[model samples]
Every structure is written in structure tokens, then in C-alpha cells.
Target: MNGWSNHLIVAPILVPLVACAILLVIDERRRVAKAMVSLASTIVLTAIAIILFAIESGPSGFEGVYLVGNWAAPFGIVLVLDGLSAMMLLLTALLAVASLVFSFARWHAVGAHFHSMFQVLLMGVNGAFLTGDLFNLFVFFEVMLAASYGLLLHGSGQLRVKAGLHYIAVNLVAALLFLIGVSLIYGTAGTLNMADLAARIPEMEPDRRMLMEAGAGILGVVFLIKAGMWPLCFWLPTAYSAASAPVAGIFAIMSKLGIYVILRLTMLLFVEGPSAGFGAQVLFYGGMATLIFGIIGVLASQALGRVAGYSVLVSSGTLLMVIGINDGAVSSGALLYLVSSTLTISAFFLLIELVERGQDAGANVLAVTMEAYGDAADEEVPEEQGVTMPGTMAVLGICFAACGILLSGLPPLSGFIAKFAMLSAMMGTGAIGVPPTAAIWSLIVLVILSGIAALISMTRAGIRTFWSSIEGTVPRVLVIEILPVMFLLGLTLALTVQAGPAMQYMDATIRTLSKPSLYIDAVRTAAPTGGDVKSSSSEVESN
Candidate 1:
């Protein structure tokens, strides 16, 4: 492979890091230059992401493992660009572009470091996805969380600050737990590289193996907290609701990062032996409980932001459940569901902000008049000249409807196609002697009910925003803001139209994920330079 192609893994992390650093030195007053640099960086990032995805999605077992500084594996930092990480990088780049464009409307000017902080956030997310070692993962996690803290509180508001603080505290605890777990695992297993750990575990002494298990258990809890699983997820809604529109939209992928880790680790580490799939039962029940709670939250939500938050929980919960199920078919379906849902909700959050802006002027006035006098007027008010509605509102309305359809798993969209794949995988096509397992039955029920609840929530929120007797003036929406939402929803539409090929890709990726041996062998023999191998306890050393 050519040098550039071989190093595709680092491109995602590097472009944003360099751009944002340059942004930091530029005076905040130079808005035009900053935007230009930021846009150009995102364009490059998208190209790099597409390239990496293409490389990983090629012939089976192909992965780009860049050992930093040309050092050998386990001893030096290595970046693994595989199908899963590449897919995440692509999704994140798309989100970054959309969020950055939307921020240009007004949010970008809210603070001095908005552009830099955004690029830093992308750098962290891409790093976390690309890192092949446990320690680097934690470092990347901290980076992402720190950037998020600033972004969440970018705009001046008491509620926003309060929510940001809460987010900070919760994640602080997760980080601490993350450190402890990593320390324990490194001590027990004697290496931080993921494949090395997998290779060592099977040969480790019993007591050390038990210690590793305990550490992994603690680490799993950290992922659960980040995933916003059930009781641990109380902070997600408030924080998401309080953040500015573009920030909240980008934050949609944050939780999915946790799900991605859990899926990766569980598949890689727990492939055989007594502890195979160790956390299956907990993830199964916990995931189901989370889905139930999310359904309740969606049904009871009063605001569109809160509804978006609960939808995140639902998405996280579904992936967790599918992981627990541990079947190739289920995993493939969940992967599709993951892509469509993230794009749908990211666009939805941005749409909510635009729709709410229009209601701000006349919302309270309409409310008080309705309570006191039964209506804005005893009779209908006639339309007046020069009161023409902004075409922007119509665009926002269409995007919102598309989001609703996607979120609720309605037909003629990728959402329905994804859910149908999952359901079909669970229950075969009318074989008299075949019967679904209890877990499959329960999952089927929860998935359907969650869709129904999402429908109800979106319907109520849409009606209140669009059909209420509010005499609000048309909101002055910007073309930049509307374009991002269209772009994201348009991606969702593309996924729908291309479901067949998408599902095939998903199936191939899942097959690879199911085979831990394939991953272990790839990593073990990955050193490009000649290396040494020791007795039963193997180590690779290169000159």
C-alpha cells in the first residue's frame, strides 16, 4: 500500500487536530477566515473518512493498523482502522459537517472558542474510535468529554451551565471508574493492547483471570453510564435539552460511542470458554429495562428536546439488546438501525431549535389568552398583506415530518427497513414447527411498542409547535441552518433507497465481528517489520 493509503487511520484524527489548533491562534474577530478553515477541514475529513471506509469494507480480513512511530504492536500506540471504526468515523464526520454548518447561522459567534472546541471534539471522537489500546481509549474519552463540557455551555444561560456542570460531574465519575478498571486490567493481564489481552487471557492463571473479569465488569459499567442505560441515564435528557441546537445534535453520537466500545470488546474478548459473553444476562435484562423506560419517557415528554433525548436512550438500548442476543442477523439489523436512527435524531434536534424559535415571540401570549379568554379572538383573524410566511418554516416542517417517520419506524424510510430486518431475523417466515425464543419474543414486543410510543410523542410535539392557536411571527430561519437538516435527512433517505446494499455490508461486517480468532490473528501478526517471538508467553520486538 502507498504511504498515504496505509496511514488512512490517522487522517481522521489529524485533520481536525491541525485545523482546530490553527483556529485557536486566529483572533475570534476573524470570523470569515475561521469559518472558511473549519469548512475546508470538514470537507477533507469527509474525503478521508470515505477512503478509510472503502479500504476496510474491501476483501474480508483487511484492516489498516498503523503502529505509531513505526514501533511494533503492544509496545507502541497502534491505530486500527477496521470496518466498524471506519463506519463510525464516516458518521461522525457527517455530523460534524452538519453541526458546523448549522452553527454558522448564529451559535458559532456565541463564544470565542466555538470552532476550535468543535474540531477538538471531532478529534477526540475519531481518536476514540481509532485507538487500538485501552489506555488511549481512556485518553480519547477524556478529550471528548472535556470538549463537550465547553460546547455544552457555550451559550450564556443558567440552565445550560447547570446542566453542563451535571454532565461534567457524571462523566467525571465515569472517567475515574475507567481509570481504576484499566489499572486493574493492565496489572492483571500485563498489557494494554486489546488483542494482546485477548491472547493472554486464555493462558492466564485462574486468580488473575478472575481479577481481569472484575475489572472488565467495572469497565462495562462505565460504558453503560455513557450509553445512558436506564437508571444511569437520568442526566442525559436535561443536558441534551439545555444545550444549544447544534451542540445537542452533535452530542447524539456521543452515547453511540459507548455502545460501539461495548460491542467491540464483548465480541473480541468473550469469544470462547466459560466466561464467553460474560455480561450477556445483565445487558439483556438491563437493555430491555432501558427500552421500557425510554418508551415511558417518550410518551410522557412535553418538549421536543426531551423527546429527542429519550429517543437516544431507545437507540442505545436497542443496540445493547442486540449485542446481548449475540446473533449475526440481529447484529446486522442493529447496525442498520444505528445509522438511520443517529442521522434522524441529529436532524430532529436541529429542527426543534428552528421550530421553537418561531414560537418564542407569541408562545406565552397565546397561552395566557387561551386560558383567560378561550381564544386569541372570538372570531378568526384575517390574513394581512406583507405577512407572508417564510419558506424556511415549510422546509423545517418537512424535515421534522421526515424525522418523525424515521424515528417512529414508519414505512417508506430506512427506519422501517431496519426495524423490519431486526423483526424478521427474530421470527422466521411462517414455518409451522419453528418458534422464537423467549428473548426474541420480548425483544420483538419492546421494539414495536417503542416505535408506537415514538409516534405518539412526535405527533403531540409537532401539533403543539405547528397547529396551536399561536399568533407568532414567522421565524427568520437561515439557509445555512435549513441546509444541514436537509443534508442529514437526505442521508437518511439515501440509506432507505439503498437498503439492499447497506444490509449486505452490515452482514459482512457482523460476520467479521463474530469471529474473534480472525481479529486476534490479524493483530498478532500485524507487525510490518520483523519482530521476535518468545516462549509460550509471546512478545513481538522489532529493531
Candidate 2:
């Protein structure tokens, strides 16, 4: 929190923004140059994110709050980094590395400005996580969405174009809602700084508070739409399923962006005021419906891409449900689950294209037909033996199975550990003595059922793609292509092995988030590191 370390707080945003500008000047034909710049920038970001994560982890509470232009909070912009934002920054960086590396195999060259857009995306996502005010959050959100529009349509096809159009239209509306909400909240509170707003809400006049709540409610709708909550998620599956592999993989974290905002605002703005627990019921019921909808979508989906898309829904619903529970202990587990699911889904998105490369479009239909009726193979046919599996097929099969295990929340993976943590926290197993309520039990049932649904759907898809293909040909996958998938899955394995320390981190994170005063005080008291202006501003603010 001093000198250079303080500057690192803004490096995550500035690095990418500078890199994006550098990328914009490079010729489109210089693909390797562009890739190198993008990859180097992302790797540096990953390093900075790690350092920030460590700094926050070592601290007891909020520590990295940087005031912009030597101005005080409620007057100038600020960037705050605590356990939650640090973790998210690290997650986004990891995903960016994986996705960018995977794209270099071919996807990077398929469209113009892919590297530029990718860097812009990193800037936007990083900025969203770091910003200390709601208006800046909207600015970063729009930056993120604008970059995504190009990424979604990167490989320009009819399917991608159609999905991208729908994606753009929906998000544009969300952006508008975001603006109206911010305007109302500012109109009522006279400020947009989150910490200032949090401080004022408890003391606001009742009538103005009511208007603020209405604005917050509108903002919640916008977040839910981004989070892929049911009835507002009609566009997610199509848009996700149509993108190229790496783009889709990176896109996985975008949904969690919405979840991130919801968690932050709920903890900071509504934790202790008239707005306490505002929109909890809507989140609860909507999450339940979303879980059920995702289950149905997974079961009915024949395409692997669509299944991955629906799986995103399942992840979002579960997180929203956990938030609705409103327990800090439960939130710790939810954080673990969020990281595990995002990584798993990203790996799955990258793996899908490889697994289905050799299969015919009609293969799924034929497999279903065989399942409906009896297998067409003759009963007299002898079983084949000693037919050694090709190296490519074996590698793909292993990765695919790993994805299945993670997605289905099966044993011996981070996914299972995360869910178990949440369930245990829900059951009041450690230091928490409250019995499970009807709603908690219902969520428990849905969580288990969602796992089962995922298992069935993934198993079916796995068999059809790996076992029932008539071509029986291995895909022409390169080392660069498959390495990213394995690298991501490898991270999940690491998470599983380090669950003990990981949960400790989660526990500390929740402890910080559960106390709104920690965040509010950190932002409010953060002073600029300069000459007399900072001193004057600090003295005036104190008065």
C-alpha cells in the first residue's frame, strides 16, 4: 500500500489499455507480432494479479485503495483492491492466458482486430473489478460489452452474426438500464462513489431512499440479465454456442462479471440499511427457475456447444442462489464454486471443438436413433480387443472425461470440493448452528439434481462424440491447441489438491466482504500520495 505497490493497483487496467493501443497500430498481416504482444501483456497481467492477490491475502482487510489524480474519494475516481477483486483479477488473467494461447492456433488470424479486441476486453474486465464507484462500473461494463461484441463475431459466420446481433441488442438495453439506474441513484444521493453512497443510504430521507431502491432494483435486473438468470437468459445459449472455441472459452467469465457486481453491491451498498436484503427473494426464485431451466436445456441439448452454454446457466443460478442465502460462511464456499465452475466451463468450451472435429453433424441424430431403438450391430458380432487407442484420441478422451467429472461435480475434483463446502456451510456444520430452512433444503435438492442432470447430458454427449462416431478418425489437433485445455484442467486439479489453503483464502475473503465498514472506510480514507493537495483534501474531508 506504499509507493510502487500502490501503483500496481492500476497496472491491471493500464497495462491492457496501453497494450491494446499498441496492437491497434500493428498491421493485420503481422499476426505473430500481434499474438506476441497480446500474450506478453496478458502474462504480465497474470503476474500483477498474483502479486495483488498475495498482498490482499496477507492483509487483514481492505489495503489497496488508490485515489486518482491526488484527489479524495467522493470527489475523484478511486480503485480499490481487496480479497474479492484480487481473486477475480487473477481468475480473469488466467482465463485470458488460456484463451489467447488457444486462439493462436488459428482463431486469432480468422478475423481482424482480434488481438486488439482481446486486450480491450482484459482492460474492461479488470477495470470493472477495480473501480470504486457505480458510474465507473457502468463505463467499464460498456467497455467490456463492446469488446465482447467483436469477439463474439470474430470468425464471421451466419450463426455468429445472428447470435452477435441478438447479443448486442440485449446488452445495449442492459447498458441503458444501467445508465438510468446510476442516474437515479446519483439524483437521490448526490454522489456516485460506492463508499459515499453506502455511507449516505442509512441516513437518507425515506422518500429519496425509496427512489434509490427503485434504481437499485432496475440495476439488479440489468445484472441478472448479464448473469443469465431465467426469463432473461434466452440470448445466452445461442450467443455462447455460436462463438469460436477460444472466444467462447474466454466469454465464460463475462457471466460471472454480473455475479461479481451483484455480490459487491449487496455486500457494500445494502448490507446495513433500509435496503438490507433488497431483491433477495427475486434472486432466490429467479435462481431456482434458472437452475431448472438450465437442467432442461442440458438434457434436451444434443450439440456439445449448447450443453456448454446451458452449463453456464447452471453455474450462474447456483451462485445467485448462494447469494440469496445471505450467509457469509456460505459465501466463502460460493466463491470457491465460482472459480471452479468458470475454469471448468472455459476448458470445456475449448475442448468441444477438438472432440467433435471428426464427427459428422448427423452423428448425434444417429446415436439418439440407436439409443431409442436397439443397437443395430449384429448379435453375432465378436467384441474387438487389443485395438490400441490413438494417442490423440486418448488425450482427448482423458480431457473430455475430466471435463465431465468437473461439470457433474463428481468426486476427487475441485468442483465436488466446492459444492461440498457450500452444502456443508448451508447445513450449519462449522460454528454455525442454524438449521437448514425449507428454502435452503430446496436449493440443496436442486443443486444435487443439477449435478445429476449434468452427468447424464455430458455422458450422453461423450458417448456420442467419442464412441458412436462413424468416421472413427482422430482430429487434426496441434500441441498448441490441446495444451491450453490441459493447462486449465491442470489448474482445477491444483485447486483440488490445495483445497485446504484455498478454503482459508475463501474464509478470509468472506470475512472482509461481510463487513461493509471495512470497504467503506478504506475507500473514504484513501489519500493521494503527493504534495499539499492531498494533505489539504484530507484535512478538509476530515472536517
Candidate 3:
């Protein structure tokens, strides 16, 4: 991390922050100007994320650390970039670009300061991914959540406001839990820096270690709620379903943010200490329950938006379960699944609004009634005839179908490839001669069943939205609105086509995560220039 690249480490956060300030000062009526600024800022963030990702991808993987105010870790603010954070940065940027572009159609104008809030949200997400300390992580989390509160209610409809209020109330409690957990951990470990905390955990006394674990468990609860774990996620479907299309699309990554933190902390804090294997069973069982719940929600959903919302739970549950597995080989596949499912779900959310556009409000109810009662049994059944689909309807239908295939883990898509990778990793090579455990078998069964459920639900929804409503008016969709969906879906296809390289990247990430020492060493040894850098916490203690 030298030269301009050192600055690149902070660009993702700064660009958005600056863009947000600029967007704020601009007249509200200049929507086009604001849109350009926001879009440009996001594009720059995307490019920076790409550069950082490429840096980490080098022959000798590099962890770029930007020491704020030229201060060392555990004493000063630091931003650390590794494979995991860099990958998350890229994912967030990509989703931001797609969602922002889609919003230009109309959603951006539905609310004042939409672009500013959008920038703030990006800044917070990027900062959360880049920050090297738990304290800053909390700061970024609040920033992200605050922006989400406004974004959730961006359109300001009755349903949006109601869902937004619930979303806010739930996350506020999570934030309070965050503060309590951080306080407990800091009191026990005497450090808020993640690397410092990891270093100190192993050396703590039994009682102190127990206290730390309790704090960690509480912290895990916060993330599990964000990850939409069962029982805690009752608000997810309603809130997400109520949000506007682009807001919902960008929100697809918000759940993954929780997963990212859980992955980061689980790898960095609990891997080597006395706390090893902490919260594994909770995540395992919790994830399974969440998956089952999501399956039920999907099956029971009548509206496309609600179905998309439940599908988010399905994605989150899979990731949580995979992380709980704690195998590097399995995590590699989980990473792939994370990216693939996110792209698919974001596309699905965007497509849902378009697919349901101009649809009769009672279409779903009528479809259900028709299915149950056989249409009066004798009301002169009309012979089926081929209908020429409009170009827009055809495109929406194709996108909807693509979403279904991806969500259901059907063949020839990244979703199937990801699930296959995990299953294969668990099964292992025949030469190993070790069979998977009953738990693994259970996971396999649940995963397969979830996919089947998604397929059935998606098919049913597709029939109601596309086929049964064939006589309905075609939606007036703009080229811009449809392109974002197409772009996101195309990425999933690219992931499928380039599964080899994508999995290679994920494998490297898993390798890095499996070894906590690598991350600890990188952060602890990072040096700053331009002034006298303070020694790390360990050096100060030694002195």
C-alpha cells in the first residue's frame, strides 16, 4: 500500500461523502444535476473498488491499510482492505450503480434529498466494509441505518411509512444491543480495534473470556437480526415489500452486510481464542429455521414483492448456515452463493415492480380463487390460443423467468453452480473416504428442499403475473428501467459463464479467512508515514 494506492483505500468512503455534500448544496429542483453527481460518484466508487480488489488479487495478496491521521492501530483510526472487504466493496458498488441507474426513471424524484441519502448510504456501507475497528464499525452501522430509515420511506406512502417505522424500531434496538456488546467487550479486552481484540482474547483470564463471549453472543444477535434470521425477521418481508423498486433492489445488499460482519468477526475474533466455535450451533439451527420460514413465506406469498422479500431470507439463511459450517472449502462455495444470490435477488426485486405494473390489484386474489374453484366448471371454457406478447412484456417475462431459475438453483445459472460447489465441498473427493455427517446431510436436504420450494412458488407467481394476466394492459416501461434489471441479470450469467475464475477468487478469500493470524499480522504491523506513528497496543503495554 504505497503511492496513490494508499489514497485509493479511502476513496470509496470519501468520494461518496464529498458527492453527498455537493448533492446537498445543489438546488432540489435540479434533479438531473443531482442524479449525475450521484451516479458519477457511485461509478468512481465502483472503479476504486475494482482497483482495490485487483490489488488484493495480486500474486502476493496485499492488505492495504490507510492509517487516518498517520496513527497506528488500537490507538488511532485505521481502514483495512483485505480480500473480504474488497470483495464486499465491489459488491456494494455494483449494486449501488444498478439501483441508482434504475432510480433515475422516477424514484429519485419521489423524495427530496434522495441522492444525498443514497450517497450517505453508500458511504456508510463502504466505511463499514473498510473500517478496521469495532467502534468505527458501529459508527458506520448507524450511518448506514440512518440512511436506510429515510430510503425505506423515500416514497412516503402509507405502507412505506408503516414499514419504515417498524424497520427503524427494530434496528434501533439492534443498535442499542450493539453499544452494550461493544461496551462489554471493550471493558473485558481493553481494546475496540478488531485486530487488537483478537490478539488479546487468547490471553484473557477465564472469567474475562466468559464475559467477552457473552458480549460476542449479544453482538451476534444484532447481526442475526440484520441477517433476517427466523423470528427476528418477521419485519423483513413487509418492510422490503413496501419499499420502492430501486430502494428494494439496493436493499438486497443490506442483509448481506450483516452476514459480512458476522463472517468477519467470526473469522477474526473467535477462530483461535478460547472462544473458538462460539455461536456455531446458534447460527446453524437459526439458519435452518430461517430457511424453513422463508420457504413457507415464499409459498404463501401472493404478491411478487412479498415473494422477493422472502427470497431474501432464503439467501441470508443459506449464507448463515454455510458460515456456521466453518470449513474453508465450504466457505468458498458460500462466497460464490452470496454474490450470485444477491445479484439474482436484486434483479428480482427490480423486475417485480415492472412485472406487476398495470396489474389488477385483485389479480392475485382472482388467480387464487380460480385455482381453488375451477371457474364455475361450466362457464363455457374458451379454447387456448397463442397470444403474441408485446416486446416489453416479453422482456419482463424473460427476466422474471431468469430470476426464478436463479433463485431456485436451476441448471446453467450461477445459483446452481454455487449450491453445487457447496454440496461438492461437503461430499469431498472419494479418495478422502470420509462421509459427511448427519448435520451435513440435513443441510443438504434443507438446501435442496428450499430450492424446490422457490421453484414452485416462482412458477406459481409467474403464472399469475404473466400467463393468467395475458389480457391485461402492457406496462409502460422505460428503456432505462429495464436495462438495470438486465444488467444485474447479465452479471449472474457472467458469474455462471466465468464460474471457474469467480470460484478461484472465493477460494482465495476462504483461505485468507481460515487463517486469522494473517489478518491480525497485517493490521498490527501496518505503519503510517508523514509523522511519528504511535506503537501498537502490544508495544505500548511492553514499554
Name the candidate that leads on lDDT.
Answer: 2
How would you encode candidate 3's per-residue C-alpha lDDT over 189-281 as one tens digit per residue? 888898888888988999999999999999989989999999899999999999999999999999999999999999888877688989988
What TM-score, over all chains together, does every model reach?
Answer: 0.94, 0.96, 0.97
Kindly list the per-residue Cα lDDT of model 2 for residues 1-543, writing each as its tens digit.
Answer: 788899999999999999999999999999999999999999999999999998987348987898878788878898999999999999999999999999999999998999999999999999999999998999899999999999999999999999999999999999999999999998898888898888889988999999999999999999999999999999999999999999999999999999999999998888787889988888889999999999999999999999999999999999998888788878889999999999999999999999888888788888788778877654354568988878999899999999999989999999999999988877874246666888889889989998999999988887777776767888899999999999999999999999999999999998888889998888877766754334432443364
What's the best-to-worst order under TM-score?
Answer: 3, 2, 1
Candidate 3, backbone clash total: 0
Q: Could you give me the TM-score of model 2 versus the true structure?
A: 0.96
Q: What are the per-model C-alpha RMSD values against the true structure?
A: 3.0, 2.1, 1.6
* Top TM-score hit: 3
Count of steric clashes across candidates, in order: 0, 0, 0
Model 3 stretches with alpha carbons more than 4 Å out: 381-386, 429-431, 531-534, 539-543
lDDT of each: 0.86, 0.91, 0.89
Q: Which lDDT value does model 1 have at 376? A: 54
TM-score of 3: 0.97
Error of 3 at 509 (Å): 0.5
